[model samples]
Target chain A: MDRQAILVELKKVLAPYIKNKELLDGITENTNLITDLKINSANLVDIVIDAEAQYNIEIDADSAENMVTIQNCIDVIEEKLSSANS
Target chain B: MHSAGNDVVAFRLTDPERSAQPRFYNQILSPSEIALFHSGALPSLSFHIFLWLCWSIKESAYKFRKRYHPDLVFSPTAIPVTEIRATAQQITHEGPQNASTDPQITGTDHQITHPVLQITGTDHQITHPVLLITNAAHQITHPVHVITGRTEDLFFRSELFPEGIHTVVYRHPDFKSVRSGYAFLQQALGSNHPQTNGATEPTPETQSAAVRELVLLDLRKRDPNGAWSFGKHKEGYPLLYRNGVLQPVPLSLAHHDQLLGFSYLLPVS
Candidate 1:
């Protein structure tokens, strides 16, 4: 899947937990998942679960630790998606 | 340094090398953590709630005694330097008789009664200092204190240490199905359940739920209706759990909240 497509899906996963967080409106590829968007880590949990469902992959503890930044999360998702296809 | 939106209150705590710096340091709290408190996701405790406790008696020690909101110390990152028993004897033999002659310290020598943590004091090096948490609710049930309401004492002390290892007197009767770190702690501490051990086993979902319930219980006044409430409680602040009893988790597998970053202690050794 393309980067844009994955980011769009990411937004949907983040929607529920980030209430009134205008940062969501400005979310972009460069956006930092926690710092920029103001999305709580708890919400990030929901995002990961959502990510697994959309891409049909599993995120383990060690690998998940790398998803600190938005770009990092996207990279992980892309990696997962690509692997699934191969 | 300012990555996304984390209101990074930069502190020098993480680096052991700078542990000797005379300057006081600060650190940034994570985003989800910001949501936990500021969002009113958690409640705040009022002085009135602690009216009957010991800190209430030592009015002078309260920094601002007559004031409505008395000042309380919130020291986090207190290092767990093995068991205090071994360390205490060593210190006693080496130190002077007036171990707590710091004239600034007041009241019934809280320094002695409390447990000592080998934390990086303001001076910065990882050194031993006694933790004198005077919260009325914590440890009230310990046999010595003879305080009532087992659950109340247990819940407050639960704030300091995660649970397990050190046994506190009061045991809060927690309602089931609660979600939060505090809830998990209560269950973990109370749990002698065959399969689980505090630091050994990863905190199960059941334990997290227990922690959440306990957090709500500690800040009960703010969360009158329980879980559904969505806003900051009294202090209108989402202060980071000072010691970070939980933290720096792999944001991948766990929910930000569920990640349980280097949070409160569960006794590793």
Candidate 2:
């Protein structure tokens, strides 16, 4: 529900796909999924699906496209979670 | 300013069963694209290849436009592939009388045959024909699907291979001088390299370096005396420099799984 909690969950979701464990350990809000973690673009969709299942929320195409960075993913998830709760 | 972009998708890394799921592909394809898939237009191709082909094209188009629009985000649904059609490669026969005078016909017996694809989109139009030549010595009759699509004003041509798919997007039709190529990442990285072993996987940094090396090697062959170097522009687009001077060429680099792809616009002589 909180940013830190969301990040923890996000890390768990991303850990399997990331080849560089060091980068994942040092990931920040500014860390890019493609450029930073070197996650394949094709795998981005899988991340989205995993995040959706983890958060129990649906991500539209617009929000999914903006999930290029860690912060972007958190923001979208938070927005979706709040909207669903409301 | 003519710009070019390219992307490659390797078959080994991607999961075909996962990609065919609606929940997965729904985020990637526009509503119209979904309709086109069921429209029987691509009846022969599997859903997995079709989906990845579209993904590669949109990725290339995003790169092509990113040079001009630095703030652009990649939205696959936003940049749609409006049309896709398969056409046979045309073979022109030149008679001896006109063979010498015809500039288009290079040899006396047969003309070059190309697998052509015509694609039209909302904001831009592209016609991509993969030039496969047939001569007295060899005949290449394999049909290649030429997919042309546009993102904003850019046009792209994509070729599907048994290994994967490669797509290249450019600014305009007149920028037909845009050329592209792809190679297996393992082969490009060198067969003797220790990392080439199956025990260790290739990192993105290593893959990027290998593609840059491959491009530079090809460029050096064209201009042997020029000192060639590859670097990125301030806008984060890959570029080439010769003798410390930035070449007018617009270049793009992409690698996925085991395939490395690069495309560049040739400077007018």
Candidate 3:
């Protein structure tokens, strides 16, 4: 799957948790989940769990710890997908 | 450098929807802790309290370790909350002995009891100095002095409110007595800022933002040096800096739901 496709899926997964509509509208690869979107830290757990189920990928604790940004999530998703394919 | 770390969890924030989610719990807790959590022994404690207890311990240990390991990326599973044992009886006796020597400390030293948590990790076994504040309704009946090992009997007092559960790691107990305080502000709702220090100034737009601002202000109120900077390692845990140099003093701030606060164990002369 292409990176853009993963981004699309990520947006869908993150839609329910986005607290700030303005941030959701303007979110980019650089948009920080916590700093920009104002998502509570506790909700991050739900997002990670949801992402795993959506993408059919497993995220180790190290990767999950750094998933502070949209780009970080996309990168991890893409990497996980690539590794799964291989 | 000596430091402390803390985390708070408001009971109202406990999401019933996510409570049944197994994957969510797995990510934050160790297998052993998970079992212990489900065990019948801790019937009085809720899952939210149990989770935050471990989280606070990890956070405290992380804050202490981050000083030396700034490059480290903290994984909660990397360090588990191995044990949280009460030291009230032991510390209560020690409190009066030291209180007699120090003129500044007041009241019955017995009132400051704080629990100590054992943290086990892949490469380290660390004892984190911790204080657990339960809701006023569910308050631990035994009130003990918050004594650090270094200060021996000097009690560092943390006022427990009736709201949520609070866990604080006072990493630097001996350098000086820990100055720990917290405040609950009216939720800023549409505006995002909560009234800080009961000041009339415009509050920050978000509770997290407001809590951080309040913590910085509280730290300055206690520290002789008003000038301070927050330095973070490559990852994002904060490093306390003062006078344009890294200070050994470790400071930690936490906010949950409607509450925000800070803790610092000041360096001794």
Candidate 4:
């Protein structure tokens, strides 16, 4: 429901795809999934699917594009959750 | 303005089933592209590879346009693949023999036993040997698909490989002067390059360093005596320098899993 909580859940969703554990441990809102974590672009789709199932939210194409960074992912998840509740 | 961009998708690292799921593939491919896929244009490639091949093309086009539009965000469905043509390349190796005397096969020491694919409509050519190594002679025929696509006003060309796919974007067909290459990260790093600085680790930092080093190596091969270096433009795009002067060459680097890809424009003489 909150940004921090969403970040924690996002980390769980990303853990399997990211190969660098050290970078994962230090991930911040500014951290980029492709550049910082070295996660392959192909895996980004998996993360999106995993997050959709994890949070029970539907992410459209526009929202997925913004999911490039950790903060952006949190923002998209938060927006989707709030919109669903409303 | 001269520029080039490329992207590589290592299919082995991708999940074929997940990639084909409607929920996932829908986010990437538009309705028209899905219909195009159903048209059986590329019958040899699976649905998942088709999806990723389009993604690689769009991603490369994005990189090409980002030089002028730095605020661009990559929305795969927004970039469309308008045309696709497939051709089979039959490569046969009987045994160790003399390499082809064709000048087009520049700098090739390995032998090519069969005729290469010659596609019409575009100036399709392979300046480098298709098979880098042929220790044991064998025969095989593989399907290579050429895809043409556009993003806004920009156009791109892509080729499918056994393991992955590569795409390059250009403003015009005749204006497309970009040369591209792809190799395993380990192979690129295995070659001694001073930029590695003796660092052999496969970290994200080293991965990017290896790409730059590989591009520099290619540049040096073209002009042996040129003093070359790599730097980034103000818009965050990669650029090359020769003899302390900024060269007009635009460079794009991409690495995923163990694969590394790069493309650059040759400076006009």
Index of the highest-lDDT prediction: 2
- lDDT per residue, candidate 4, B1-269, as tens digits? 56677887766677777876889998888888888878977554557767887788778877876776677777777677665555445544311112122111111222333332322221112221222221111111111211223224555555544445556666655332556666656556663633233344356677788778667666777789999887887775787889989887888888765566787775665
Better of 1 and 2 by DockQ: 2
Per-residue lDDT tens digits for candidate 1, residues B204-233, read 344334433333343343336433212222
Q: After superposition, how far is residue A40 of candidate 2 from its true place, in Å?
A: 2.2
Q: Could you give the CAPRI-style class of model 2?
A: medium
Q: Put the candidates in TM-score order, highest first.
A: 2, 4, 3, 1
* TM-score of candidate 4 on Cα atoms, chains taken together: 0.78
Tens digit of per-residue lDDT, candidate 4, span A16-62:
88767777789999998976788877677788899999999999987
| Candidate 1 interface RMSD (Å) | 15.7
* Docking level for model 3: acceptable
- How much is the lDDT of residue A59 in candidate 1? 64
Positional deviation of residue B194's Cα in model 3 after best superposition, in angstroms: 7.3
Tens-place lDDT digits, model 2, residues A1-86: 99999999999899878988888889999999988888988788889999999999999887998998999999999999999999
Fill in the DockQ of model 1.
0.05
For each candidate, give its TM-score against the true structure.
0.30, 0.81, 0.64, 0.78
If candidate 2 were superposed on the true structure by all CA atoms, what would the RMSD be? 9.9
Residue range B36-143, candidate 2, lDDT tens digits: 777977554567767887788788887877786688787777777766544434423321112122111111122233333333321112233232221121111111
Point to the candidate with the largest TM-score: 2
- Chain B TM-score of model 1, please? 0.21
The better-scoring model by lDDT among 1 and 2 is 2
